[model samples]
Target: MSQSETPSLYASRVPVFPRRVDGFFRRMKWWIMIVTLGIYYLTPWIRWDRGPDLPNQAVLLDLANRRFYFFWIEIWPHEFYFVAGLLVMAGLGLFLFTSALGRVWCGYTCPQTVWTDLFILTERWIDGDRNARVRLWKAPWSLKKARLRLTKYVVWALIGLATGGAWVFYFADAPTLLVDLVTGQAHPVAYTTMAILTFTTVFMGGIAREQVCIYACPWPRIQAAMMDEDTITIGYRDWRGEPRGKHRKAEGSDNLGDCIDCNACVNVCPMGIDIRDGQQLECITCGLCIDACDDVMAKIGKPRGLIDYFALQDEAAERAGAPPTQIWRHIFRPRTIVYTSLWSLVGVALVVALFVRPELELTVAAVRNPTYVTLSDGTVRNAYEVRLRNKHGDERPFRITLTGDPALRVTLEGTPYEAVSVPAQEMVLQRVYVTAPPGSDPAEGARTEFRFWVTDMTNGERAHQDTHFVGRGED
Candidate 1:
């Protein structure tokens, strides 16, 4: 293909040896690493008071119980839409952020990038910096290189194992599971999960690295569509840096461009791209290049920011005689506003729903096969399958009150009030019979509303359901 048809910065299939950097971006990356990794390692150990019968873990996905507990909210299987809604909101929020800032998530919050950087840091610390690592890789295998590589791999393996072990703790009681795991008594599923997570962690963090961001991930493709010229991204000031020339020992050349032809920016880039060329699909907009270039500029006695996070629109305006305009509008555009409003509404609705959720529910189904039976005593009796759900964590005694009319009398064939005790988190089916007063008919072939009021005796929690009372006619 022609150069015009091709992209500016072509993707690389080779591995990169990103040199260690010490600057603002590096420190930001360090803090992100610490906070994120700390959360991952420590959250499983945090305890929550979830009554006596339930697990005390602060966050747990109780798959066996079909329940999800996070701090205080207890989600039932039917409430999966809460999770779905949150995911939708998260996706929209990501879109909004990407529209405003290019690939910032990949730089800061992406788990793959974070973990890979952590692993790389560990490798660099244990073995050596980029140059030393490259030398070790090039040299024939020796005892020193062997020992260093062996130690690094062993540590990497342990880190991967720890990552896997922490994940399954969210499914079970962490302390108990830890003991069980050590004693080799954990369930088969726990072992299975740990193994799978370990494989993924080692493969992704230790091996795949930037390939995940470039080839495996779909985010860059999505972001390409979402981003605009006003989006602030890491860019090289080509106007200032063009006509790059070699730096002299005394820095005496007036014609030399400000860049000084130093590859410091390229060395610090985790994705291994030269920013001086232009904006690129491979750039994560990490600002590390800016930091690197700034340090280089300081050494060369030039003002910093030869490379920077810039908006294309502002650059273009500055390139022309026109005054530069404010460059960011993606964060608060119509799409973002709509996404925020809907996301907030869903969050508020879920919270309210959780608060007002009932402890029990009632369901009534009229016997449709033979709808009603007329006894010889001139009383019309209706049969219904009443199902009561005790959604609480303890056995509940529910009083079923029937409401229709004053003349309407209720007589259960064997039980009174249709009252039945249901076990905790269980449902019970009962055959209920309703009969009107003697010689009194609601109406021929008509259905009257029958209401069932379920009140939990223990907590005074109440639930109600209304259904039709089938009679010979309208009742």
Candidate 2:
């Protein structure tokens, strides 16, 4: 092929300037953006009175201490099952939403979508609407363009920084961290994380926008598996709006469909694709196109719903002059019901586990180097390392005891008593010696299985760990 005739391997990106539109879905988007952003930025500042010893932040991931605090609930490192269960519930919830309403999460609640919408709003405020943005794009570089561009970029950067700042606050005491960050006294990791998140938020939400949803995200491809014919998704009714024409009073206009080919739907689409071309991966099902088309239909004196949330199963029935299926039937079907049940099951299980867990925990490991030591006093001694965990907010005395043989005696290495005081929200290790009287049956036996129990003196909560108590074997 000639050099000129050879097609270019790459196609440059076409910037999309979505036109501003006002309707039911538009208002819904506005409200959702406000609620989600408000929750994200303000949650870290909500103080929970979790005693003076514990963190005061309502929602915090105390990585250094290996604890997760959410309001009244505190999760220890060993209780990671709660986090795993929550992740499972999140997956199930996503599946349920996708099965019921295709890409609803992507459209409204996805962080990418929400931030992109915010950026677009900022851009619209700084630079006029769609047509003005298009004109500015095409016009030669000027001081006016530079001023608008610089202003928009500055605003986007500030929003990105705030997003990053809010995320870091979840990992520490918000007020303390904020002060440290401002004074340059915070850890380097904190600054590094915030910088990375800031860059990504600006690049993905402000610059990449639709490209992130169409390419960077895996959900759009995976969504096909979750969706079915019954899934309600935004779609164009080509059956009713075909043979599109603009002229209404012309001779051939009588045969024309409701669509005037005005491209209002396409103009308002953030993804910048024609919805009338049928379902595409780029479509987020945001319903902005629906709002745009409905407005156009109302103005043209035609019935609405040229573009609307539709189920593929209803296409044949509607084409044959039957009324569309009820939305409830599509949403409450077996697939979505199963997903909802699983999600709720996981959530309930996590709550039960969180409430019923013991406040005191014990773990014991036998020191096996010499197995059993023959003490100078003619006693068989088995040493063990025991860890006592106190989950309460205040220090509590824990009474240690063993269950196996009545002849066996337990003693902590440094202390003469069987009780040790564990600090609040801390685990303490101590050397424990289990001894049997020299002439007892347990002293001569090769091994005796026993459980070490730690009882909290304050609340009587108990935890136990099982281990083997070695003895002198018979020759």
Candidate 3:
């Protein structure tokens, strides 16, 4: 291909080397990363005394048993609505934060940001800070560069492996699974899951970095809709930063802004975009630029907040020679209020449902192979598969009874009229037969509605399922 005919789609990738900066936001980010990573890696090892019958891991999704155990709460498969409710609350919380804080979750707590920050920290520790890294990138292949690059990649792979390993612990008994994994006796699914997560972590954090935020993640696009003028975002004070110069007292620059054009903010930005260019969708609002600019402002004997959390509305006010709005006013806006209320209501409702739900459950399925059968005495027998679930923590007996038809007689196939004993936190499927005595015949082509009631003998708790009984033509 000719030089003029180069494909427009073939764009080269550029590397970002963010310099280290120290300030309030930097310190906060350090603490948040520490806490979040600690929780992610260590939570599965934390033990809660869930008794001998249940797994002691504080938070576990026991797929084998179809149960979710979280600290003191144990959720059955039938109670999946609780998990769904939590997801809804998470979405609402994101909306609430975005409405008031402007992509704060993406900046501080998102997994992509957190892992990428960790990866960058590793790169800086092995290679050097921004200037050194830039030099290394431009330098030709050498033994020193090769050694440093190898060491950095090894450390990154280790971090990714640890991240993937930690995630698998949440699905099983952590200590046993760890032993199995180390001894090469774990399930293939476990190994496969770890491999996939490790690849994603390394690829996304080490290789992709800001590309995931810019071209991959949907939150950046959706956040624009969530943000309004009152949203607090990391913004440059352009009203005071315009007419930029290297020195405030340059020739014919008496009216220059306080900005010295040090490029510190740009050098420290992970997204490789200037905040002075105004708000861009690529920016994660990580606030590193704020720290860099604040440090510069401090060194130059100027007041801080040259690049700070400032609302766009306040930008207009500041340009009009008025003070910016208060932080509390910016926080308590209408959208945030609505989102908070919705999140809180869902949480409360889930809590209530969890506490009020029955400890026993019943489901009945009538056999349709032949629909109905006639016995020697001309009685109609309807066979059904009844499932009884014991949600209590101990094995218990439940009395099975039928209602909606006084003439219907119920009998368990194996143990005829005996109470069914269900193991703790388990379900039992039993074959049952409901027979209508000969003289109790109903009209032809009629279906009789009945209820299968299961009452826990230990606690007197009860649950019922309504089903229909098929019958032959009327006598």
Candidate 4:
């Protein structure tokens, strides 16, 4: 290949060794990490008193029973559409928030960031701070270095194990499972799940780290299109940081900009990209770089925020010696407003449907195999396979009534209405026989509608189904 045909540059993955810093942003990140991780690991263990027969865990996905319990909401298989509606609402919500603020979820709320930060903390505790860890990594194979690395791995393993153990409690009674787990009597499936989660957490959080965010997660690509110049993002103020230089004993230099050329931002970036170069796809916007630079600026007696969260368009405007423009697009712009309204409408409709759902449901398809039969008593007879359902926990008789005309009569073949009851989550196959007198027919085959109505004696709830009553041709 000719020289011109060669690619401009080779792309490679670089490792980030982010340093810890203290500032308002760092404090906020700590608070967010603690609160979010606390909720995630502890929520399944929180108990709610939902009668003796129901599970006490506040949130559970009882796959064995085909039920989902979330606080006060209990979802059955019949309510699956509600879950779909909620998912749609969540998607629209993500879009609306992304349009308002660029990648806030990626920076702060992402699980990868949360767990990685935690793993890094454990690393710091065992090995010391950023500089010490770098020195240790650079040193030869010494016993001290080996001991520090060993301690860090042990801590990482423990955190991963705890993370995995917390996840399985949502599937069963948390307290009982914990006892069973400690006694080594827990189900094989439970231990297998814990093992898998442990491996993933350690590998992704301790080892892979930001690679998961930059290369593995697809959100960054999708968000690239969602962002515009008007979206507020963590950006370096080029106007403030450019023309950077080192400081000397001299009072000031004309060419010297606000940046002191300390490389603090680069040293502390989790993704190892220089913010001064440009905003790259690998930036997670974790804001640790902001904390690092701000602390450096404070030590040098310079004002903070040489880099910051600002609209890039605004930075450009200020760079051109123009008045600062309000660069943030209003959240109520047409597209965002429409999306918000649609999301709210979907949520409202789902809530209404959940609250107003019938306690009992009846579905019927009249048997088609022998549509009708002639009775020995000279009346037309129709045999139907009917299934009875009772959603209530306590069983009771169902008063079945057939309503059509005065001459129409119905029977349960060999049973009475008082004997027909379906237990909770149970379906009873019933053979029903319907009869019509000769006077109840037209000259030819007549189309008459009959309703099978059932009233629950336990709750007074009623359910009904209407179908055709076929009559034979007679003159």
* Position 23, candidate 1: lDDT: 87
- lDDT, model 1: 0.79
Model 1 quality (TM-score): 0.88
What digit string (tens of lDDT, one per residue) describes model 4 on residues 228-327? Answer: 6666778887777767878634566666777878888888777778888878888877787889888888887778878887776677787888865554
Worst 10 residues of 2 by lDDT: 466-475
Q: Which of candidates 3 and 4 is the stronger one according to TM-score?
A: 3
The residue-by-residue lDDT of candidate 1 on 1-475, one tens digit each, is 6566665696556667788878898899889989999998999888998554777888898888888888877777777988887888788778767877778899988898889988999989986888887788888999998899889888888888899999998888899999999999999989998888888888888888877787888877778887777777778777777678885555556665787777988887888899877877788887788888888888878888678776788788766766655543535667656767877887888778777777787787888778778788767778878788776767777777787765455555456654578887667887777777564546343767768677788878777778776667642
Show how many residue pairs clash in every candidate, following the order shown.
7, 0, 1, 0
The candidate 4 region of ten consecutive residues with least summed lDDT is 438-447
TM-score of 3: 0.94
* Tens-place lDDT digits, model 2, residues 280-312: 999999999999999999999999999999899
- Number of the top candidate by TM-score? 2
| Better model by lDDT: candidate 2 vs candidate 3 | 2
lDDT at position 235, candidate 3: 93
lDDT agreement with native, every candidate = 0.79, 0.92, 0.89, 0.79
> Which pairs of residues collide in model 1?
443-473, 444-472, 444-473, 445-472, 445-473, 446-473, 446-474
